[model samples]
Target: MSRRSSRRSPAITSTSPCPCGLGETLGETLGECCGPLHAGSTTAATAERLMRSRYSAFAVADEAYLLRTWHPSTRPARVELDPAVRWTRLEVLGSTGGGALHAEGTVEFRAHLTDAGRADVLHERSRFTRVDGQWVYLDAL
Candidate 1:
């Protein structure tokens, strides 16, 4: 197995609320943060939570989590989250906005994965939204 995502600073603050924007409480987010593995984060803790959860969704093949955390309009009901893929690491390039109560935000991230023992990359520019006091992932480019 690869190094745990916790190798760095304990990704999520055991006390801060998650930044996935899924209308879930701190307790709920904590469960996810401590469970299944995901990608690493840099800079802000909220951004880390978002990145880590996305990785967890991928690791566990939790299509629902992926969709639920995803901003509705641009999100799909179901996706074939590949199970054979093994994610290596995540590099958060940059993040902007999405602060305060309700607003829009964007996160640019680089995800590295290994498929069939071959390395691959997913460089995406993702969008996010804070609705009803929750941050939900929108879509990625």
Candidate 2:
């Protein structure tokens, strides 16, 4: 396994409620809640769902998942996450496209986090695209 896989934190469990606050219980493992994106079993059906899973990936420090769901054209070979940063909450502002019939979409949201005893919020509008039938993050707008 790579360092990123080896460092996969065990902070979240399957039974734990989704960190994205979607009021849905996780599956048998952290990958279950977002298994489609993580395991490639199926692509996220909607842009909003993709965005939620991405947020959950950050909360768990699953760099692998983040990379897997990222568009290859813009995806980096590897990702380095700040261990000190704790993603606390996600508030989705809105979304467009990335639906059953659309191949592209955009999701806007705010992510709340705390790092080194400092709390901060990240607001962004993210773009997504369908690559080989999977919705992958393209970039921030």
Candidate 3:
């Protein structure tokens, strides 16, 4: 039988400072606010928060967080944000639209991961929307 990979790894140690700059450790930073998004702007701010949280989810394989923030239309029925998928970096190319209560925004990022001792790159241009006063992931290209 083929052996599938485990999707949850041991928690980060105190000695390890997080690469995302959220905190000294992974668990400590999951919900910690990093940029302006932490305070709540209703539009751009929430989008920013979602972006950061998604990255954090990728780093820790927090599938629950991913689903919670995803718009129902685009959210996958199920996701395997594998813990074995070693996240390497995150970058926000540009963002726009804080004018209306209901608005759209874009996030372009490059995610790096390693699987089976080999590396892979996932580059995406993602769309987000403000729904019911929260930012939700819509789709990714």
lDDT of 2 at 30: 46
Clashes of each: 3, 0, 0
Candidate 1: where is the Cα deviation over 4 Å?
Answer: 1-48
Q: Per-residue lDDT for 70-116 in model 1, tens only?
A: 66788765666444576666667787775553377777877787787
lDDT of 2 by residue, 25-55 (tens): 4333444566446556766788888888889
Instruction: Write down the lDDT of every candidate, Cα atoms only.
Output: 0.56, 0.79, 0.59
RMSD in angstroms between candidate 3 and the native structure over all alpha carbons: 5.9
Clashes of 3: 0
Model 1 poorest 10 in a row by lDDT: 36-45
* Candidate 2 residue spans exceeding 4 A from truth: 1-7, 24-32
For each candidate, give its TM-score against the true structure.
0.63, 0.86, 0.69
- Pairs that collide, model 2: none
Global local distance difference test of model 1: 0.56
